[model samples]
Target chain A: MLTALELIGIAAFAASGALAAVRSRLDVFGVIVLALTTALGGGTIRDVLLDVTPPTALVTWPYLAVAGGTGLLVFLFHPTVAKLRRSVLVLDAVGLGLFVTGGTNTALALGAPPYAACLVGMTTGIGGGALRDVLLREIPLVLRREIYAVAALAGAVIVALGDHLGFPPEPVAVTGSVVIMGLRILALWRGWNAPTAPKLDGV
Target chain B: MLTALELIGIAAFAASGALAAVRSRLDVFGVIVLALTTALGGGTIRDVLLDVTPPTALVTWPYLAVAGGTGLLVFLFHPTVAKLRRSVLVLDAVGLGLFVTGGTNTALALGAPPYAACLVGMTTGIGGGALRDVLLREIPLVLRREIYAVAALAGAVIVALGDHLGFPPEPVAVTGSVVIMGLRILALWRGWNAPTAPKLDGV
Candidate 1:
């Protein structure tokens, strides 16, 4: 079940990356690179950090096929589908929730402590997006005023706390994911943001 | 001496990032972000992969200061500094050489295998710039034209081979660094570019 959600998230994220690449005026090659990175970059970092040999994505072809195929499809149909950008953002939110929860869950399964799992989850959720922004030369929305990673952190912490308190894994994950999605919507609606760059002062 | 050179390289790399940000027409904050990432992102990645506690630059004030401070200076002097953009490419090449050699030396010191160390060196040399390109939404030089990472790889391989043959560390490092710098310049001057983006029609 969780793996199913993760795959969905991957596809959504890849689509988002492809859309961004198109908006950035990239060629087909660039679109593919962006899609692959958005879909795989976070998990790749996590696996590399955990020393997961060969990486899960490299272990099979489906992951690559899904990300790449989805990206290509989106790239080809973007002009037709772009009007649905708002709907896509909602899908992006779902993916974000799943990714953050999945990341934290995977970390815990690997025997990381609650705090570490939560951190991993946060990284998982935002890592690919951050990489995407970096490639696009845009300020990462994570570091900017976006309530993006913060929401993931909050949800991960909740899920981790639930697990630590003996909650069943399934419930904890679902609860956490829901919390993340809800919070993201709230954040957007409320225009929540991190503190702006410290006011520049003449030293 | 190594520390001084590292600082200089960091400054130059940061300046290069800042200049790239200008070419992309980013705002002041964006410029600073690009500068810092260009100078320090690769090392940060290396530390994270190695699981080093605190990561060197974050632990040490000077390295952190150099990256960000250089960005600040470049941002303040954008107009004047932008005029030297062409010359900055020369400094960028020099910094790439220093970075690759430094990364290779550090990896070797950590007792990594020659092949892995060489890869580490190559990654460290190109990682920051690649990241900067990614952020700017430009095609990464590593993924596109320029013998950029190829130069680092060649230098890293040479140093590794020298080490295996019991060559003195200094000579190996010096020659290796020179090889990278020389190749980089030749590639830049002669328009050497790696193959990329094979046709998508078949697959």
Candidate 2:
């Protein structure tokens, strides 16, 4: 079940990445590169921070195959894929939730400190999209006026708290994931925006 | 001797980063962040790839101190630093040389394959600057028309070949660094550029 959820998340992220590349009018190779980065970049960073050699994403052929295949599909059918933007956004929220919870659990299992685990979890949830935006020469949405990182950080904190307080891992994971997804979806529905820095005349 | 050289490279990169931040009109905190990222981002990525946990930059107080101190200095003395841009660029070339050679040697020592080591070397030479540009919402110069990555790759190839041929490590490292620095400086002086993709009418 966990593997299935992970694969779904990877696919969703890959699709979103491909769609973004298509919108940017990148070539097929660029689309594939973006898709793979978006799908696997976060997990790779998380694994590196936790000292997991080779990164699970790199060793697991399924992750590469799924991300690459999704990229190709989107490149060939971009018109149809573009029409599914709403669905992709909803699926991306699901991906973010799964990544944050799973990353936190992994860090905790590896005996990382609570604060470090929370940070690792947040990095895992947001790193890929941040990388994608960076490669596209744009400020990352998480670092801009978006509630995305806040939601991920909140989920990470919950997971870390659960682990610290001796709660059941399974229920805590589920709750954390739900909270992230719920907050993200609600923010979207309500057109909520994170606050930006106030305008100043000079430094 | 090697430690002193490494510190010099770190300081040079940090200064370059801080100067860029000043040019962008970032506040003090932002300037410091950019300086650290520019100074240590490449080594951090290389360490992560080689499964070096916590990263050398994170564990070593000297690295952090040098970078942060350089940032503070640049922030307080922007006009003076701006006047020294030419010297900074030369020092940046030196840093690129040291990082590329050092990164390749580190990767080879860790039992990575030759091709992977070469790529890692190039990444180590260019990664920090790439991150700086990405954070600044600009396309990385290495990925644009700059001859930067090419010079790094050429140096890496030489280092890898020398290692495969059982050459003395110190001499080989010196040769590689000299080649990279020479090539970069020459490119700057001669106004050489890497080729860009041809404009296409349609996808």
Candidate 3:
């Protein structure tokens, strides 16, 4: 079940990347590269930080295959894929939840301090999309004005805190994932945004 | 002597990052973040890839101190720092050489394959600036037309090849550094650029 969820998250991230690349009018190769980066970049960074050699994303052929296949699918039918905006958003939420929980759990397992684990977990949820935005020459949405990172951080802290209190892993993971997804969905539905720096007149 | 060179490289990279942040009109925190990222981002990524636990950039207080101090300096006197364009470029080249050589040697010491070492070495030279540009919402120059990555790759390949041939480490490192810096300076002087993809007049 966990494996299935992970695969779904990876596919969703890959699709998101492909759509962005298509919107940017990148070539097919660029599409694939973006998809792979979005799907795997976060986990790779997390693994690197945790001192996991040969990151699972790098050594796992199946992960690459899934991302690649999703990219190809989107490339072939971008018009149709683009039409599924609502579904895409939902999938993105799922990915955010999965990555946050997974990243936090992994960091904890690796004996990272609670603070480091929370920061790393939040990054793992947002880093891939942030990187994609960077490649596409846009401000990362998470940094600009989204409840994204806040939601991820909340989820990560929940897991970290629960683990600290000696709670069972399964319930904490589920609750954390649900919280992130719920918050993300709620923010989207309400058109909510994190506050940006106030404008200083005549600056 | 080597330690001094490394510190100089760190300071130079930090200064470059700070200048860019100033140009981008980032506030104080953004300036500091960019400075730290540009000074140490490459090495951090390289270390991660090599499975070096607790990235040196994160663990070594002095590295952060040097980068932070340079950022503060640039923030206070950006006008003067900006005027030293030639000096800055030279410093950048020096940093590039040191990072490329350092990254390759470390990867080799960790028993990474020669090809991976070469790529990692080149990336260590360019990653920081590329990341800074990405944060600033600009396409990385190395990916566009700059001869930057080419020079780094050349230097890396030289080091990796020499190592493979059982050459002395000190000489190989010195030779690689000189070659990269020389190529970069020459390229700048000649206004040379790596070829861009041929224009599709009616895409």
Candidate 4:
């Protein structure tokens, strides 16, 4: 059941990446590469940081197939998919939640301290999109606007708190994921932004 | 010693990243983060792909110190250092050569196939700069201009061929490094670019 949720998140991210590639007017190879990076980049980072051998993304052939297939589909039918932008944003929030939960849990399982686990979790949530934006030659949305990374960090902190309090992992993970998705969706709906540095005068 | 050469490469890359950060006008924390990422990102990717546990960059505190100290120095003395752009470029080429050699040798030591080792080597050479560019919201130079990735790839292929021919690792690494630096410097002098995709009509 958990695996199913994770796979759904991966597929949603892959689809989002495909859409971004299409919007960027990239060729087929570029689309596929971007999709794979968006779907797998975060987990790859997490696994590497936590010293997980062979990184699950590389070992799991399904990830490549799914991401690549999604890219191909979007390349062929982007106009149709582009019409569902609202739905895609919602799905992306869900992916954010799922990845945050997974990353935090993985870090904790690997004996990372609470703060490190939270950071790793947030990184896992934002890493893929950042990589995608960078590849597309645009600023990362997480760094520029909205409450994205903040939401991920909040969710990760909750998981860390639960661990510190000796709560069961499953319930903690569920709560964290729900909170992350909810906060992100609410931010999207409300047009919220994290506080940026004040503009310097005459710089 | 090989270790000393690698340290010099790390310091050079860290300095370059610091200079970039200073130019971007990032905050102190951001400068440090970018510098460390630029110094360590490539090796981390290489290690992850090769399943090298607890990546050397993470385990080695000196890497962090060197990168962080460089960031601080550049933050304070950016104007002075910026005048040495030519020197920095030369140092960067040397760093690229060293990293490619080190990465290829590490992969071979870990029993990777020659082709895989070559890819890993090239990745290690370019990954740091790519990460730095991405964080700064620029397209990776490797993907767009010059013969940078090509030089690294050529060097990696040489390393791989040497492995296949049962050549000694030390001499192979030295040869690859020299070739990479020479090619890169020549490309810079000649103002060469990798063949770009032809301009599309009316798009």
TM-score top scorer = 4
Against the true structure, candidate 2 reaches a TM-score of 0.59
Ranking of all candidate structures by their DockQ, best first: 3, 2, 4, 1
Task: Determine which window of 10 residues in candidate 4 chain B has minimal summed lDDT.
Answer: B194-203
Off by over 4 Å in 4: A1-44, A48-105, A111-122, A135-137, A141-203, B191-203
The sequence of per-residue lDDT tens digits that candidate 4 reaches over residues A112-194 is 77766876787788889888988787756664443676689789999999999999999999999999999978876665343
Worst 10 residues of 3 chain B by lDDT: B194-203
Candidate 2 ranges beyond 4 A from true positions: A190-203, B1-43, B56-130, B139-203
Residue pairs in steric clash, candidate 4?
A: none
Off by over 4 Å in 3: A27-30, A51-53, A58-62, A134-139, A186-203, B1-36, B58-127, B137-203
The CA lDDT at B191 in model 2 is: 56
lDDT of 2 by residue, A1-203 (tens): 77788898899899988888887889999999999999999999988887988799999999999999999999999889877876788888889999999999998898777765776797798889878888776655564434686689789999999999999988898889889989888977665343534342100
True contact recovery of candidate 2: 0.33
Native-referenced TM-scores of chain A, all candidate models: 0.89, 0.92, 0.92, 0.91
- What is the C-alpha local distance difference test score of each model? 0.76, 0.84, 0.82, 0.80
Interface RMSD of 2: 4.5
The fnat scores of all predictions, in order, read 0.15, 0.33, 0.38, 0.29
